[model samples]
Target: MVHKFAFENPHLKAEAVSAVVMTDLAQQYKVMSTPHLVLNGTRAVKGRLSEETLLAAILVEAG
Candidate 1:
C-alpha cells in the first residue's frame, strides 16, 4: 500500500526498514507491525491506512 503510494507520488520520499535487522531504528520509531508510518521523524501511524488518510497526515506533517 505504502510502496504504491510512494510510487505514484514521486515527490514523496518513503523508505522501508527491516525491524529484525534494524532493531534500534525500529525501536526509535516504536514500530510494532508492518506498514508503520513515521512521518517527519515525529508523527506516526501504525497499521494500514487509506490513501486519502495517509495523504492528509503527510500534508498536516509537512505544514
Candidate 2:
C-alpha cells in the first residue's frame, strides 16, 4: 500500500504525493519511478534515499 505524509518547520516543509493517482504531476516532474523525491521544483533525486542523502538533495535545491 501507498501512504502520504507531511511535515513543516520554520525553515523547511514537505509533503507526499502518490504518483499513481497524480499521473500528470508525476510526468510534469519527470518522476518516472517510485520513491522519487522532488525538492522545491528545482531538482529531483530518483529512487529511495537515505536521510542524509535526501537532506543533501533538498539543500541543493533549497539554495
Q: TM-score winner among the candidates?
A: 1
Give candidate 2's whole-model lDDT.
0.68
Write one digit per residue (lDDT tens) for candidate 2, span 1-63: 112122433566566789999999988998878788777775777876777777666667767
TM-score, cand. 2 vs. native: 0.73
On the 0 to 100 scale, the lDDT of residue 7 in model 2 is 44
Write down the lDDT that model 1 would get.
0.84
lDDT of 1 by residue, 1-63 (tens): 667767988877888889999999999988888878898799988877888998888888878
Clashes of 1: 0
Candidate 1 residue runs with Cα over 4 Å from true position: 8-10
For every candidate, C-alpha RMSD to the true structure in Å: 1.7, 4.0
Q: Give the TM-scores of the predictions, in the order they appear.
A: 0.79, 0.73
